[model samples]
Target: MDYGIMFQEENESMKERFDLSMERIGQIISEETVPQPFRDYFVRTASFIRMMGEYLRFIESGDQKKASIEVLKEWNRKLYEDILPGHKAALGGYEKSYADPAYAAARLGEGYGRLFSYLYKEIRGDIVFVHENRMKDITILNETFIEIYNMFEDEIPEVSTVKEVLYWFVSDYTDHTVSYRVREGLDPSLSFAVDIIKNYDLNDLKYLYYFGEYISDSELKTASFLNSLPEETVRLMANTYTEGYCRGFEVMGRDLKKKGMVQIRYELGFERMVKYAIENFEALGLKIILCRAAVWTVNTNAGRKAGYYSTSPNRQYEYDHRYDEAIYLNKAFKDRKAAVLKVAYEEYKELAAAYAGPAVMETFGKEGFKPVNKPEANRLDLKQEKLAVEMSNESSRILKQYVPGDETSFTIIAFPVPEIGEDFEKIFEETIAINTLDYEKYKGIQQSIIDALDEASHVEIRGKGENRTRLTVALHPIGNRDRETNFENCVADVNIPLGEVFTSPRLTGTQGTLSVSTVYIGEFQFKNLIMTFENGMIKDYGCDNFENPEEGKALVKQMILKNHDTLPMGEFAIGTNTTAYAMAQRFGILDKLPILIVEKMGPHFAVGDTCYSWAEDSPVYNPDGKEIIARDNEVSVLRKEDVSKAYFSCHTDITIPYAELDSIETIRPDGSRVSIIEDGKFVLKGTEELNLPLSGV
Candidate 1:
């Protein structure tokens, strides 16, 4: 009856029994742990099983409900604070460990890895075998165990049972597990930091131990840096993020008061800022949801993006496993995940719809992650790619079914962490100042440029210096000056630290070459990256990130284009964040700036869905009521005929730095071209203020 607290009830005796079992497992590992290289693995596997029990306790012991937050924090501290650092160190040794196939087999053979992996995958997969009970879903959890148990016994089961278990797991839990595993998806009260910060002293290093996230110099340095900055700086950072979130509701014309939760996704270093944002959201009647980076299955590393997470221990390992699902993914799994997602959404429909959206803080600049190309590390086969595309499209549809596009609005803001370089602090301050720039003045000035661009049928942009990029983007027609505008007058709120004028370019006439010298899209870097566009879709692409040209193309497909054969040029924008660009140049860390900041450094284009891909029907006003008619182009409007084909689910901004640009000219229907920026400086009369930083620096 109390199955909800099944693992929670592990008493001292039960824990002792687990310990003994682990000891025996460990002894077996030390003896038979073949290859000998995996000695350390068998060692850690034992610890993992033991530690998970601690987590199991706080999760189920409704008794610790009062101190549960602190308990959970302590449990996490054990994971991140205590274990992760050493785990990172041990990983270096693992390369040598795995070299010995015998040891690798022995270590993996310990069966404990399979056990926890099974438990994690199964329980999280949303098995509600005990569905009539109020505690939690047990049916779904046991199916995973049964699979692992079957595997553990080395006994093959009937094909139908395996299929049934997987179907229910994927179909019932993709959204639920995805939303649960990461805060951005749903489950608001899970902010890992909120519990830690509330229960421990911010000034105490001991406090870091409770979070269960990896603790390292980077995390500690980040926390120390923000704590040392004037409280005003921290408040400014929080205000920029929170105000933008509130403004998202305001801009979308959605009622903020009705939304009960706000999802906060960030790397571990910014807990101080997150702490403030959590409080700020609370004041707005919104609760905080904080989930971890995907670990179990179903939703692990997809690409450059990870939801709420700490710095990665090994980015290359992640890169290798990004497509690990290819091993078992099939039509049945896809249908199952979709089905689980539907069932889970129905089960948590109220929570799903109530989720306001995510307030994201993305980080950049960690030794410019150059991933090694691993050929043997499983990849998604061609068949899997099609199925994956269909699955994701269907998953998105099913998710939207519960949390309709019209009801939710989200915002993203990014900042660089200390890992950027020696000048991390200076870069951070400059970034902060740039985020809080005077939006009122820019708004008026942006309106003038927007008015001029509104009259253009097409815009021509040419690259200067070594930059070979030359492109043309077509604009939508506006019969009335009062009703439509070519570009959205982006100010500070919603997209905090704002600095861009963006529009959904007309796909029919938009054609030319869009290229950048070097840019970071998610995790991978593109060198001498070039994409040719005809009728707005990427016609051809090539980059020089890897020595092998085929590898280079594959990297682009995997990281940038996301395996899609082609993507339409969804957005064209002019970034007015010159001040921020100046700071980056001043600090000599231009490559270190995150896209959130870099996208505002120059005119950038996004090749995928437009900014309002899903919420196009939701009216969006840019302070002034001029309806933004540039919401849909040829590609996205395909939703009317086939929803799956309409959205590409990717929006990557590639910026051409101000110094690299030759000029931007708005071409009118009368054959006259008017210059908005000439020779890398704002020439539009009203936008001269944008050049202040240029002269000052």
Candidate 2:
């Protein structure tokens, strides 16, 4: 029913209000009453906002669709020009706008400068929202900034007064932000992505400029490459993606018919694949919910991008602003956010009920990012850290209350980007082959390892060749040997290009050190990463990624431990995809592989929540008719008594390469041992087939 037009018409009054707010912003920019430094700040910020407003008007004008390729490229460049790699330094004013809290506090007085800095940062991040025609958000945010600017007329306001003004501003708008976010996650009518996918002529490269993401060479090249592929190849890629998602439901024994929608989380430039995927998903009666990644500090989680995104122009910018919420985070703010979230979920409870889960397509092969630890970065203090963890747990509980995790299923797949190097096409095709590997072959090999593991009380893994990893992972006791198994014979469902049999280890006796010479997690690269565990919980962790020991430790704490005192070893698995590992080694792109694929390259351990976090109670079985029973660890089992204590809501996998691994042995209760891998080669009775790939046979 032309919902986009309908929505625009319904919000005609909002557009008028937005116009008035932009005019007000312009007036503030020229006001002479404010002091020099303060006036400068306001002028620069408001000018940026005005530019965004103009962009918004252009988008709303419907001229973007008719614009020529050059015009669209220009618009796209203008939208992200401030944060582009080469131009970022020129935009330092935006960084300095909020950067030095101490300098800001000194310049604009203790309370006022900090608040203004945060407000400026918030406004800066909302440029994309403006471009996307999220008029209400931009309008309300602009009005708040103007309201604050208006307070500086005759005299500088009291510190307490400024704090109260900002606090109330956030509190008042909490419902608006939270409710719209929740609604967008479930409502298919908010069809920015669907319209772009179904309506736009995707073959035209100009269509890539429509989404408000930074258009980089990587994205442009990726889209061009996919465009060059045959329609059958594109269809096959989409079929693999959607079929894996469907298999997730079937394998888990969940009813896909019960769910009406699935969220598509992906990188930009893969819209061609996404377009095909949308059609395939529709055939399964699932509508697409293409939500943008978190742009606002309130919605962002520890610098991770959640939804559709482009290659980050500046990783440091993201790193510096990861904890921007620390400026206003307190018990009161936390409670207010939770309350608003509850109300929002309740408002959209019906839509949330039919929500299946996220189907994630991740991209890799970018240069390893080593973030410079900026001193000006906002960091959560001890109290805020505790509160952050609590809020995450509470938020998870609230979300599960509406979209019960047991009923939902998700799938994740990864492909290389053009940045993988000169052999991008070759690597891409090899990746496709790796993803479409003989699942039945892996099933047989992994089951042999799983059967060996199930008979053991604990497995011993020791690293060879300077890797320094030695660990003992306890297995859950099998209740019925004939009908129950500890590990699931993982294939390509849920986690694509897969070859692993994993289980939540019994944490009571799981102990030792896990070390990797080099590994990439999210965007950060770690060198000489070493994590020591005592009774399955991380005891001491260190990495030589930074010159300063303390700085390196802080990085580890933020990224891996996620500010927790300790995280339990939630999962343990042996990655049997020697073919993927061989492909990576052949291309010298092992360091660039995403965890989604790299986790299947060797034995890896995940810290935080287990694979089955909120869905621990859901019964799952392998193809062999044995129910997988090792779904919960000591920590996850606490869900029944207190869910807040049960899950950490973060799972980070750290893998050790096969070249560095010594041996993996199953230690039976009868004091006998069966070696699955010896000296980095599969030596088990039925798993010799896996060694062929590593041997280059």
Candidate 3:
């Protein structure tokens, strides 16, 4: 289907207004009406607005579909060249790149510099807007730029004037932006991304540019490598991914027949695998929903991408603007956003109800990015921080109202990107083997470990040499041991290449310090990370990422805690994937692995909501015909009374590698202990095979 035509009538309706915004923007490129440093900002920004208008016209003419590869490559670079690093000058050589918030703050006064740079970054969303034929969105942004520029026409207006313009722009447009985003995730008809994936020729790499995401060397080489793989190899990748997803519904007891749609979240350059996975899901009666990752400032989630995207052109640029919402966040705007979300879900209630949760394909092995926290960037104040938390709570509630968590299930798997090193191909193959491990064999082995754990009242974990981790986790009491198991016998379902059995621990007696010498969580690496838990909630935490201890604390708080003052110890699991640990050790890429695989390589603890966060009441059973009963802890139990206090809406797993381990033992109610793993090797009777992978280390 030609989905572009869906926007044709609307484009025509808004043509006159769009043309006027373009005409005014075109004049500002050369106009001397605005002042010195600020004049450069407006003039350069106006030039970018004109470029977007050209892109919109090109797409509207339908010429993009037939463009040659060379032309397509040139356009893709041109669209993002302003933000790409190492450029001599950005936006026409007038000054250093304003797209760099730090540079902009350096040139302009800190306040105005941050605000203008943020505005310019937001205006850049026009790239995606044009690709999707969002004429009204493009027109509104163009007008916003003109309005801000008009302020400077009168010899530097008060900062309040500029702030007011941005404040209302976010306020007034939240309805359109948030509503469209919610619908984009549910309604498959909004198929700007799906159309390109389904219709484009896989052998031609030119299709990468049509998505409008930044295409780096990593993405290009990744696509080339996949194209060279055998068809059977590709099918194996697709089968592992799709079957894990289907198995999520089956294992979790969610009815697959009730869901009509599945949202595919993946990186660019995995189209061959994603396309095959689409066919696999279609065979299972699922329509694919592929939405572009959020571009608008209001929709972007703290520099994290949710939908489909490519490698970031500038990680620092994204990091600096993560809190752009601080420019206009208030209780009124927060309440307005919540109300808009409810209305949007109301309109798409049917589609939302039919939605299965995300099937995520994560890529690892990029050079680690430790961002320089710039003082000039926007930071939320105390009141704003609390308001932000409230907004998250309300939004989560609204989402569950439409897409009930109990009815939806998700699966996640990871692969290595080409950026790892010279051993990229070897690492990729090894990753595949790790993902497709013998599921039946591991199932039986993991069940043995689960049986031992079911007899414990709590688990004792202590760190080996130089890794001072002393943690005691309280497990839920199994009511009727014959029919109950505390831990799920997890293996390659929902979480692929799975090798761990986990549970939500009772928080009353869960206490002690958890520490890791070096660990990567998301894009940031924490050095000498340590956290003190008192009664299952975070009492204190610190890291050595920054010279100043307080700065390191702030990083942990923002990224891991999601701005909550404290979070509960939601899950505890002993990883059984010795093969994966050995692979990382052989490649010496331990820090480059993603959490999806790393969490299965050692004993890891997760803080926030448990594995059964919103679905605690749902029954989950193991392969042994026993019900897994440890779904709720002290925090999650509050869902029956008050939901806002029940969930933190975040789950971050911090793993301690085998080399850093001492021992893990299960404590019985009679003051006896059963040893599970000691000195980084499995000592249990049935789990000795897990030690074979570490033999040659």
Candidate 4:
């Protein structure tokens, strides 16, 4: 019976219902039915909703009469001003309003206040969508809030009763939210990004405001900087990025022609580069999908942003709300989400089938964030934690069904943001140089390192001066030593600025203590980080990030271990990019470099999934035409019987900087040892060329 027509009719009915619900809410806000403080809160919230509704209509009507540069700037500022640092501290605003959970619990009931805060935060995230004329989402959330408000009008329900209603709201709407998110990831037809990039005059800074992302000074300066660069420079940057992505497919032996679309994820300010990249990908017969990072908590995983985004207005606010799913997550909710995700993928099976993979442009050099642990933040219990992991596994399985992992390949490259320092331009130029280093030279140098590694039964690494790292990494045995190699001779392909030969090590004999004096991972800085491995899996881990030792351990668990009690050491490699290391040391920006580049600056170890991940069976070969055999380790081999237990879906690389290295040696079965590096300098006979960059340091 024409499901599309039926769905349209249902959508119309919902819109009508939403209007009536909001009208009733507005009336309720006028009447002082609830107590004084609660009434004040309702009035203020309802006023904001009314303003949003008006703004939604204004934009939907194509009212470009007021979309001039100055007007748009004011509009963007007004929209985001409340959450900006100074304004967020103002009295009775959104931030200060929900600042204290205990105070809220006292004013409202314990459960009611928590639920209300969650509702407000969720609604706040939808403001951008509302302005974009995507009202279906905001309508549903508003309708739900109205339903709960109606229940309070006549009588305030018990705390359990209120909590149950909130839970059911999330449970019932899971299908809608989950499906929309999955579709956004797959379907390029929803071209919010394409329209902006193609239709707007990019030279006019006003276009940046149309995205509804919080535009910071970094974004402004970045856009201006790109505008100031010659067209050739922009094209060069784009060419390198797109070429790296194409090479990834070639290297992995995947047919790029079979795929019709590619996902483009980057920070907002780099539109010039992204625009050129779009043209480049189109030249390769690929359409681009530019989705935004997840706005709703249900759609977010492990608090990492994906897709195109701007610099966050408040990292602490994001951290404070990362685990909001704890309010409603359960086995039932998990099952419901899994079922909905399956349906969503099935609906978009055709698009998913043609999906290539992500081409990501990561940015770094933001201010280091040290999050203050707030008691008000949600924390997942043991059962919920287990459910979260299972849910991730199940979702991945569903995605793999349509978009086969072996068929898709991805490339990641990073650039520095303006926040890096006064030397931002110098560093930016150096980064481009680093990214476009002579691949032929690196190919030859890395092959030498890999050749020496192929003869080793295991490799030992030890740290120098105040750094106490010591470890043994077991290499895969070569049955036909004349033709096979354990490590891949990696250069600038999937991983740009790449200068490393890496392998999935045999886990049985890999054991050690890995320590770093200081490092910045993701958005947080770690001090005196240490991890102990027994048979390759993390046996113990800790850092001195927080004053309390237990808090520090918790940070390690959440960030590196990724909530797993233990994860296997999946990868070990020797970084051959001493040039990058020297540049960072010269500029004093080592701590600000992203892992995409930093991982190649020294000997590094990865925990959790191997670099191969779901593509263990995919044949990969080096330049010399030898298949890399070390794709799967002890844990990944479990995929034959139980796929869920086979993958942890997280890989965190912890690197030992060259300054900390004492020595790295390859030990053969006959007890003969060949040294690759000693006292942080390349001492291997054939690889001495790498030391030229570090000469006289």
Candidate 5:
């Protein structure tokens, strides 16, 4: 399908108006009216924007489709060849760069900033119009487009005096552009982006390339397949998706009505379902923000990115270059980002106020990611890591200062990708079934286990065979049964196809060796993973996948452990979703599953930030209406006094499947043993139904 024709029959007509923005800016830069230094900057900026525009127009025309390998090369080039020049200039504090003090002051002081601002706004407006209101001729989106376009329609702003305009550009755009940095920092929920896939016409492949984002066959193919699914099936998929989002708000006890919107972040191909989710959210009176991930630095986060996006054309390439920040690190770069974000948020305060948060539709089931580590690629050295952490913390604090942490909520759900293996479709169908599992059945069984756990002072979890996991997680005793419960009875909401009773374990005596035969953490592969915990924090870790010892250590350091010297074992729990495990084994896609889904497949361990990071004070309860008292470990408790020591800003799960386990036992206060899984199978009496999937074996 000509995706544009799906919504935009007049994409050609849009050409003239759209090209004019860049053309007019080019005209201004070419004009002799602008001063030499100011003119030089716009000359470079204008050329870059126009090059991007031309490239976008080419992709939009749906001609000269490049092969995946070719696209991947360009993708590599853009991140390396094309964009790095500008990033380096800006980071090095060069006067010629846009972030230069003299240039910013001049650009903002002169009317040039606002004109360029207006020009940039026009391009942004076009992108937004294409996304939000895709109707006849883009008539609705172009209404604002017409108003903004007419600025150049009247007296063209002078090129010579553009400094002052640039300041307002930064000032006006700050609030809207950077609001999520806070949302991410504070709550970090998946609801931050759910509608991207729910409402759009993913079948309209033209929409794929319109955002000026680089795209490859992988992304287009993914979206096309999803669009091919029956509309009803897609709706069921979306309903399962958005329902998890709403349930998050309901479970959190936050007032969803106060919030007016939900940000939908997703990959390509899921637009058919995205549209349905938008309607579902709208039915609840929440508007949807369908923002794509950042292509420009003003909104980029190097590796840890959010917003609607496409698949990484190459994960190895991405892994190699994740720490691109080292190219331009200093107090100056931080200040520039901070100034820009602050300004952007100020501009969008009203919209930010209306945001409920993100509802993410995540996908998994791709082959296990075994990223080849590249040492030459820029990485945050020890000093840079500290600075990066500090910058993140400060920026987060800046965001929360505007958007309160107490106000929003979110949810995340992952599905399988077609690239998982030979039985991709079969696994995908099974995953859907898992996502829509019987809530009441699991809830009842989970409560029975929680009831048992409430009586225990601590849970002793040990592994067998190649698995060396031995951790004693102390449980917070439930003081009152009538008002509170020990573990939250996880169902098919928020975390779908769920079967785990998890909490922030008391860290005082939570120590021992935790190991998994193999696990995928953060899209990077791990094998024969071992971690030793001392008072909950990860004291030591090792993996045997890479050849050299130091290389393996660095791999774990950068990916799994998030560069922290040590991370607290943030979460420890049993896996109640034996059906998920059975399905994985049956389909032979165990290694391909995402942690979001894999964690549900077995007993897992999380290293870094606890599940209750920002909202420990907000009381949570199990299905039996009992308050879950185990929301904090000793590390999180520091938040009540010192904020610096409170968070490690990461939580990655390493799951041990039932097949790898010796046992998962619950220890009663009197030291009695209650086995949940023994010899790689469910042995708990009430949990026998979970073992039904493994019947033949």
Candidate 6:
């Protein structure tokens, strides 16, 4: 079933529109009516568009796959060179790329800078459209360019006129863009990426160029490294990853057979492991939906990617464009987007219902990225910010209505990329061991911690040395100590290589400050990250990421609090994977580990939503038959009344390394204390075995 053929009539209609737009765009390159600096900008962009026209022809004629590796590399570079760091018109110190908001502000005046810059980025989506053979998408984008260029044909057009064109472009095209994104996530038949991964000669490495993403040494080396490994080793990697997904279903008591499809998200370099993973998933009667990450501004999120992708050529480029929606976002547009989203999901209700959620393969080890807060970038204003929050809440509700989060589960496993310095191979091997650790062993040790916690009212965590974390997390009262538990004895299931016992804390009494010397969450790094909490919700938070204190606080609020003024302390857990801690210490790559591995190395606290955000009603239990009952807190409890206020739609796990810990103790109702960890080593009687790995470090 080639889904592309279904749109043949639509594509035929779009061909005339595409050709007319291209002809008009070609005329803009020679036109003299537009003004000076802005005229050159349009001319350059028109040239790029014409270049993509040629590339599209090459791809449509089937020459791309038959071309040599060097030819493919040349095409890929030509498409992306204008924005790559050191290129003639790329972003950075002196390069004034049209894609850079700052550069746009400098070259054009501030009034029309960001608008044109975003337009350039929007046009860049042609690379994706051309590869996917989405002629309608390419045609509409060219039409948008021509529409804007027409304004310049006359005397200097009003900024309002230029903005009106962009605003309507986004508003009118919401149905097409948003619908395709939804369909891509749910429909396994939309198999652009699946065909390449399953049928291409992965050993040749030229298959890497087929995706049209920027290929870096990191991607090339990762593919080469995996290819060099034994077939058995590759199978072990795939088995560990796929088995983790199955184990998630087994542990949660969810029937995997009920689901028909699983979304496999990963970096571009792991096709070999992903190939085996595809077979393993298919054997379990699950179709694989391999969607590419969002290329359209409407579908992309800030500094986070959800589908298959490659190493970013420039993190700052993405960071600057994080809030590109501010140009046209209003209450009406927000409402329009919400309506389109609901309809899109309704159209694919069956596929959404059968969705098993994402099986994510993550990679870490890149140098920690510290984003610069550029003054010229577009930002959501106060009213727009409020609207953005409202849209987020509405969108979550709409999604849950179709694909209930409680009905599905996810598994995330991360490995190292080549960017983690000299110990890449050694660290990779250690990561495999960490991922496939003795699940039964950690389940027993974590159960002991849970037993102690279940008897307590709250837990006190104190950070030693430079880490200034002093927080008290109130636990849920267990009704029957014999059959109920506050903390869940987690193993390598949903969270791979897991070693934590966690519970949703009671927000009424939970309060204090959580501070870390340095941490990496998502694509940004925080320096001396600190948050003050009152009643388990963020009261005040600040970081040293920027020179100005306000800027630092804004960064924390944007990234951690997720635009919400305050977020509840959703989870409290003790990480017992000292072996993972030792490995990070030994390799001197503490900052390079992903949260999936880092969360297991120490006691971590999560904010926003609990581990069981939308699935609070789903029964979960520890290994010893005791039901883990603390799934929801005060915020989540509001779901019974107002679903809009129930969840924050985000969860960020911040871990405190064992080396930074002073002690963690549980306080009983009678004011008695039981020390679980003292001076960074487990002091509990039955959990002493976890400390063996700490001794080696």
- Writing each residue's lDDT as its tens digit, candidate 3 over 408-527 gives 999999999999999999999999999999989999999889989988999999999999999999988888989999998889989988799888889999999999988878778788
- Candidate 1: C-alpha RMSD to true structure equals 5.9
- Computed on alpha carbons, the lDDT of every model, listed in order, comes to 0.69, 0.84, 0.89, 0.83, 0.63, 0.88
lDDT tens per residue, model 6, 607-694: 9998888888999877788888999999999999998888888899999988889999999999999999999999998999998988
Clash list (residue pairs), candidate 4? none
lDDT of 4 by residue, 1-697 (tens): 2211323554576778668766876686578777655666566667667767666676757663357777766666656655555555344333555423434555665566666667777777656666445557778778877777667777877867877887898888888888989988988877777778877777888778778788878888899898888999889889899999999999999999999999999998899999999999999899989899888779986557789889987776677667778889999999999999999999999999999999999998887778777666677898888888888888888888888889998889989999999999998888888889999988988888988999999999999989989899998899986677899988988998879989999999999899998777776788899999899889998988789989999888887876888999989989989999998899888888887788898899999999998889988999999989999999999999899989987888888889889999999988899999999999887899999999956
Model 1 CA deviation exceeding 4 Å by range: 1-27, 30-94, 97-184, 304-306
The sequence of per-residue lDDT tens digits that candidate 5 reaches over residues 28-56 is 54565545544554565555555545444
User: What clash pairs does model 3 have?
Assistant: none
| C-alpha lDDT of residue 205 in model 5 | 69
Model 1 TM-score?
Answer: 0.84
Number of clashing residue pairs, candidate 6: 0
Model 2, range 638-662, lDDT digits (tens) per residue? 8889878898979999998898899
Question: Cα lDDT for residue 238, model 6?
Answer: 94
Model 5 scores worst on lDDT over the 10 consecutive residues at 132-141
Candidates 2 and 3: which is better by TM-score? 3
Off by over 4 Å in 6: 3-6, 87-94
Question: Against the hidden true structure, what lDDT does model 5 obtain?
Answer: 0.63
Which scores greater on lDDT, model 4 or model 6? 6
TM-score of 3: 0.98
CA shift at 193, candidate 4, in angstroms? 1.2
